[model samples]
Target: MSVYNQPRKRVIQLIILGMVSLIVVRLFFLQVVETKYSKLADANAVLKKVIYPSRGIIYDRKGRSILRNEALYDLMVTPASVKKIDTAYLCEILKIDMEEFRKRIANAIKREGRVRQSVFASLLPPETYGKLQESMYLFQPGFELLLRPVRSYPYGAGANFLGYIGEINPDQLKKEAYSAYQQGDYLGLTGLENTYESTLMGQRGIQYLVKDNLNRPQGPLENGEFDTVAIAGKNLRLALDIELQILGEQMMKGKVGSIVAIDPATGGILAMVSGPTFDPNLLSGSYKALNLGRLLVDTTSPMLNRAIQASYAPGSTFKPVTGLIALDEGVITPSFGYPCHGGYVQCGRFIACTHKNPGHAANLRVAMANSCNSYFMHLYRLSVDNNKWGGTTKGQVKWTEYLGNMGFGHRLGIDIPNEKPGIIPDTARMNRRYTGRWNSCSEVYVGMGQGLLDLTPLQLANAMCIIANRGSYYVPHFVESIDNDKSDLLKKYKEKRDVATHISADAFSQVILGMEDVVTSGTARGAQIEGVAVCGKTGTAENYARVNGVMTKQPNHSLFVGFAPKDNPKIAIAVIVENAGFGATYAVPIASILMEKYLTDTISVKRRPILQRMMETVTMSAPMRAKSKVDSLNSVSYTATAGEELLKKILSN
Candidate 1:
């Protein structure tokens, strides 16, 4: 074998060397040119996660915050791959009992198993999250904290108008065909929140990542090459003035009804208050146990938003529209005559008038000032008075069309959600009601805003704006402008002007003059603003058979509608109190205070501090305003000479 001088041995050694060289070349090629799969494998080592951006904050017109963000975390877990977390550790870290922890994890397991996506925790505030993160090592790979934003209302009340957001369900997802909502996403449930939900709920953000076979996140993953930054929802600016809203609440006190205020010139809502309001903070953002419990079990039904939902007969308030309708159609004029000798005499029954004039006649101005029921009854029939429109049926139909023009019988298309399209009767409605045998007899009641007619406090307020504007108005809106996020709503509404209540400027003058008389010396005298020149109407409607599953002697709903600075109006408002006796008694006084708070910047003229202190003590219930409270207020008296100083301070400030 040492005799390697043989050719075959030399050849075998050469072949071995050649094979080794070939193998090395192949390795080099694979590493350099054919590295498609190996590069991916290397890149997949790190995981990239995205953090959500903060949502935009909502503010009032003056830049005061109405909505804000509080830190909260959602527990996200992958069920199929989750480590089957130990119940004891989770309970200890999450500050939950074992039973509750087990139940919660089980729910997540089931939901994720069915949906194939991660299941979100119910809700965890910042404090709870801090404790969990401290001991996060015990939770393992499956559990993660997804930083989230919850909508919050800071004022703590005004539930209905502000509304609430809830987790999006299957039904909502289908309806929101253009939405990117997941099952755990939130949606507005009512009021402005619902109407402007799209603007409020900003777009969701997504990040791409690579997971190993063990589902562990590798660092950096592509340096966020596959992620898009999340955009925040736009913040809104509102027309509502907070101080004015608070005064309305004080005035409404213990009553069960609503008050609506809007700018007559711009048709912007100043306030829409429903009594028994729940603190809005409880519904979203941050909530406390005591406040939530009180609201949840409240006997007064504080959760119901009566401002736009509850509808009632116009009562005497309807008198204005009736009078205007008659004048516009030329059935009555400034000089038109109608006899209301203390009442109108009709088929064996007397429609008694509250105003007694010795003569058998009164003009349109007198009829309006007096709010004579008989005058409206006769005037409303004037549309059908001649039956000149082909037939009596056609004539009644025309009258209905005219009423509908004044923004009755339908919704005003406001920005808030869940608003009702209030009921107003026309020919078909009457046919169904009276079985096709209806005429002026069935229709006369509508003239007085009775019969099947209905209007919400909001509707009444909007109608009053029409009176103030004289011909048309911007549709009433809670928001002055949508945040940049909702420019479309603001844009669309800007182009849309509702001019249904068209009338001659002269006709409005007569109506305006009559309304002035109401607040200056007539029924709504209590609503007078000392120097602001408020014009208004008072309505006392009687309609009571049963209430709350029982019968009672409730007299009527008290109502008042008005605008200020009679020469050139500013604010318009409507207030209603259920079973509240007289409009002047409660409703007018409240409107007067609200107007003063905003326009004059003072609540009362007599001893500003003392009056404020006394009024603050005078609560909705007698028990709250005790004898001790009155005695304490009475003791804080000023001399007659000093009263003038206080009055000047109140007026000037």
Candidate 2:
């Protein structure tokens, strides 16, 4: 009886122990190991919301705010949760009709299944949001106001440079580059906004909240354990001086060209301006799409960053480079001179010089100051036809190589996008165009900054910086530094790039002396400024364009390149005004005013009248005006004829 009882007790004990173990394992799986069941259960009651981080603020070099974020509200809709609501009331508040309301709802359903929330209306005005907030409770769980950040420009300038942000397109969503982004995310579309998008667009965060049957958020789910905080974007400090930028824009108001100013010390762009610029604020808020459409069709091409995109003949500005090449090649000394009789007619081709007096070729300094075409023509011939080179092709190749080293015929590696690598006719190009018969004499037009040589305002200005720096240069960039930067954002800009290793510093000084003479007593005498030792070269580029579909010889482009305080130059600048007569007439005054403003922080009282006259002059062509959508762009005055007349009367007095 005792043995039978012991076996029965043991069997019962083993069954009970096995049941306990199974229960323990099941509890552990539900609480720790298996998560799918819990996630499914939580999905109904927990709302997982994304929190977008604020974009980085942009500041000018002086710490003045250029761009910042402003809080705006978006009316979002959850189609699945929608119940019987006041449709007319909602439409009245949003300023839309019932038909528009139905269309938006249909769009939301088509964009995302009924389960997900979609934006119904975005960037609501403060008054609209205020009205909606008062009556939002009636809409229940279907409608909600989501906080969003919209960019605002404090200073209404630099539309082409600051750029604008827009929603990601379907093409972008398909690309691997935007894999991390969702359908409704905004990205930089142009300017600095596009270039620094990664730094400006901060990391998004997630928050999980408990909701009731009505889809109302009750509280944080699981005591906020699954919630993540957003990381704000890094702020950027740009190299632009807002004051100088404004002054440059104002001076370039009546013109259709570009102005680039660089700090020779660090290659930081102090002020870069393309005339006929629109307000940067135009590309912000809910009206961005409409405004963008207007800008895209504007014939003036206000969207074009002419400082780096538009290429033009460097004109006499190329004389300095030719002189540098000749001096570096030992083909000509600073004392080398050539004779000119009204124009150069040695090769049976007449090339006119600016000098009215016919005499011996002036020295390099005098030639540069006077902008003597025959003098540079002779120097180009000597350099390319030198006996040491043996042949014209080889000499032309060597000459072209010098230009290449000086950032011509190639992209200069600027920070922004769409930089043009201006045209420079090399041996290969010349041979292709002329079937290998072209010689130095045939391409002698390049000696005077014409022919196949072209350069953007940025490249032209940078060349002036090279001469100002005496050998080396830093790649021109807008951003000076980033806040809390750890990456190598500014590394490349910090490196010194030497263009011509063989050119002596003395040669640059001699050329600079000639440039100084240009402002003091030569062709660019109008560019003189008090208390500043200005060295400059004036250029009148001959360009042809079609007028009324006929090839017409338009007014020459006015250009000026200079750097002040000759000893240790601080600012180097290039100014180009299209459809303008002479460099000394329009371009010189503009450059002089800008240089004076930068160096002295104000223009002399005596020079104010010249600034006024330059600002009042409008040189845009009739077809250019007819083609432009923005009237103010082609005409300096808001009301073209009236403003012109008023300005004429005021300036004439």
Candidate 3:
């Protein structure tokens, strides 16, 4: 019995010894092996600094800088580290009252706590920064100055195209796509900036620094072993020609409309202007937020990018598509004839023709050249009611296909954002509207480029490119090349896509001849250049809007689409002027000047007067003026562009 008790006592002692050994091992690991917790304990004396990268520069096709960066200073403060300093002197240097300084410090303490840094003053003007820098040493541990980059536009044009950058909102910070970004980061809000943000915003770097007991940064910890080098953003070379852009903007002053010029050979946009534009510099630096707010509420809709966003009836500019569709479907031959008696009188409804002469359509070329409404209406009826298709629905389907091939009823997929897809009447939409009771006669107005056809200026310009290419077109884009062309960023834009099938190249030539006749002796006679053979079509879209709660027809929207040098076709253009009459009046003249400038590098000396008249013209209406006030704000110094006498004439009108 005594021996058994002795063994039990030894076992109990061994158990107690094993517990002591485990506790010793745990203490050793926590104090000697693992260092993370110890580092966390020392974090109170560490400061993490962010090194921001400079955004890329933007250049036009001519290597002129469109967008650039300038250094601005910001004042940062840490509340807990603040000591008894010259508060009154600092406030005087910063142009703030002593009470205001106290309020700011208290607010910063509440927002980020006493241990963190907060922005005391942002984007100080050069004069203020100069004064503050002279006395910065007096503020020591509490205040510091840092450099930040702000955008500056040298060209003073392309506000809508280049876009503006601003601080990221709180909502944007919460998004998963922006998880890498912290508070107070700036990003592009619109235009080319927004479209190429990833490439334009370079990589941000970080530096770890040691801090004193009062939380003042000494120098880099461990000699910047963990620091990353900031990479500058890649530069972008755009397809835009600054001179062309400036000219277009100057031409569009005091008007409410748009002008789009494209290089038909490569699908590159040369110039795009939305009238009522503001200076690009208005959206940079400290005034950005205030100006953007004013613009958001301003009735002129100057912030809107009308070239790619606004949609309107193609009007008579759509007639070529109708003629092409009819010619392709064999419903009409190059010489097919339809007699016109002022208009198409069908199904008991009369649709009047702009050309009121009694003559035969006689041939497709003659019909297109004359813009004969009745002949195209007949072609629409023949195509939609063809016996070969056996029914209106099937034939209408075939017609819609042809429209799609022409790049109508769809977004041109331009690189810019907020592009709208214009409406093309489809079987389903027509069926819903007519309750399955519609016929070709029911939609005959569509055949003449009226009723139910909508297109963006970009789309209208692209359609001309397709015809210029004779059968194929490359997608229109703004940026031609980037710094390192290794990425596939521009691969899709380089491919020439062919959508035209079953239509012969000669078929386009027949239509081209008629379009040439238009500039030579037909309605678009104003579009003729001196040595270049211009081909164009004119369109007057009857606009309707709600006035005093009643839908009323306003003045027509003038429109024109054309290409130059008919044989090689260097440029294709589209112009639209709202509340302006006759495409041949304003749109044709504007487009012709732009074509002449691009092709000849100078306006013909003979056309200088025409150019002067256009620049001095003010076509916006009273209600538009009351809403926008753009003419007073954005118009070229009236005395500079037009003489004081001409300025008075414009103002009086």
Candidate 4:
């Protein structure tokens, strides 16, 4: 057969071509007709997104972060983008009333209309958001689910001190002072948050993006390069020593009062705590709903910064100031003497000094050492009264000017927020109260820290810091350095003047000598150390209780102020145990414990056991049965009307 005319080859080729054609057809059907590239089409239609970077953490002074942040999501909506969503169903899912849903959705529609997302609400429990997510397929273009960071405090701590941050209310937004902030901005409510708002809340950044119907970002509308990077807030380097703060809290446990310890050399606040402290994490941004009133309103007033806010009688701790003033004014010489003969000073009908020591205080030195009411009573009479007791420098007017320099008349301008300027009992106040010329009766008791001399535990401690630093002390502060940069560190407060008491150094030393004697063999024997020279004063001031109008029984406020290594002090402390019977018994020991803790690392084993036992045994001890609560601070029985709400908070805690 001729090759060109071979019908078998021709037939084979035809069959092969036919089969090949069929395979190609099938491939085309599978790739194009059957599959239809559905995955790409779906990808184009449905939107998916995730949260960006997590919020930054907050660090302590030593760079140990105490707070945490994690990613969270919020559901946003535009009313115009609505696709027949059940308004009631949506409102029910979000746990909002119809009115709230209407307001939010209306505002969102007003913001973006149908073309873009309008507004979003947060703090939705996972369940509510999950409900919205299930029906997300039914939602329209302007609906969005976006993620952000929520702050979380590791331990529920620092309620009042590290106050809770919250979303701005309408009232807050209306204020012109806050005009710079948007409605959703976080603000510092109190404590360090309020003080360091600028550094803690960094400058905000912005991002612009295009969204699909579901309000999900399609992509970076202007590319990633155009998105402003968010700068996390610079971490705070608070000067507070966590160990000391916790230890101080423990030491003050069961007591209804406060304690403040400051490094006299640096004026840095080593520890500041109010009794019945609560967890700060309770107020964190991502925190669960809590009973706020139950946390703040308590009979013990745990949230109160008693160290700096609440004022009390300084007791005998204020004796040194008066003694120094008397000496500087030359009211008495080193040889000048006053017989105590039990040291009872009669101020009108009041028998002020219930404490007794035989014989008399010989001079300024002994007067302070003995805490003699008689000596100061005489000195106060000389200082405040020009008409009578004219045995002192110039006149009473000169004395007021001197005390003003001692930080008695005004706030100390401390770095911490909420410090109270303790009442100095100025002539103006006296005039208003008495409506007559100030006399010896009104001014006499302050000399002994008895009456009209309201001071904070912190103020007392600061005053002691001044005495230890010799003449003046920088206003006590917290926050040492940040990012290891000394330059960035807060400047230490310098002494405003040469003296806080404006008394002679010699006279101050003389009074200090008596304080030294106190530790050696005095009311504050419990505060003495084997090697460290402790100088301290104990005061028990009477709080006159009135039934209808007239005063009856006296409830004493126990107080102690002191320093260690008396010649040149290191740490100065003040403690107050409200309603405690004696300052030496309760408050002094606490101060000594804190001072010893600060100065030395390891206390003697014997003393440690004794001190621990003392801490356990003694607290705002009282003879009053109904109010006596040794271990628990919130035991004050709550009754309706006034402070009940506060007591409820403590109980809840």
Return whichever of 3 and 4 wins on lDDT: 3
Candidate scoring better on TM-score of 2 and 3: 3
Clashing pairs in 2: 338-361, 339-361
The local distance difference test score of model 1 is 0.69
Q: Which stretches of candidate 3 lie over 4 Å from their true place?
A: 1-43, 85-113, 629-653
Each prediction's whole-model lDDT (CA) = 0.69, 0.84, 0.82, 0.65
Candidate 1: segments with Cα more than 4 A from true spot: 1-50, 80-86, 92-103, 113-117, 174-179, 208-214, 285-299, 357-361, 485-487, 496-502, 547-553, 607-653
Scored by lDDT, model 2 comes in at: 0.84
- What are the models' TM-scores? 0.81, 0.89, 0.90, 0.77
Candidate 4's C-alpha lDDT? 0.65
Residues 258-306, candidate 4, lDDT per residue (tens digit)?
Answer: 8787778777777776775655544443333443455554455556778
Top lDDT model: 2
Model 3 residue 424 CA deviation in Å: 0.8
Candidate 1, residues 1-653: lDDT per residue as tens digits? Answer: 56766788889999999999999998888888789666555434434344555555666656767667776777777554457556577776566797776576577766544213354454686677778788766665677787777766655434568776667777767875636776677666777777777787776666766667776665434776767778777777888875566556544545668889998777778888887454465665333333445555555556667777888887888787777777777777877767677766763367666777643236666666677778788887776765467766888777777667667778777788767768887788889999999777676777777778888888898888888878677778878876654246676445435564456878888888878877776788777777788888898877666768887655688888888878678898888887767777667777777777778777665534433442343223344223122222213321223223433454456
Could you give me the TM-score of model 4 versus the true structure?
0.77
Candidate rank order under lDDT: 2, 3, 1, 4
Task: Show how many residue pairs clash in every candidate, following the order shown.
Answer: 8, 2, 0, 17
Tens-digit per-residue lDDT, 1-653, candidate 3: 69879989999999999999989998888778988677655557777677778999999888878888989877888888889878898898788898899999998887566766777888787888898898888887888887778888766778888998877777998899888777667788898888888888898888888998778788998999988988878888988877677777777887888988888888899999998788777777765676677777778789998998888887888887788778877777788878787877875888877666655477777777788888888888889898889899999888888888777788777887888888787898788889999999878878877777778898889989888778788889889999985899888888888989568877788778878887887789999888899999998888999989999999999999999989889899999998889998899999998898888877776787887888888888877677774544444311222223333342233
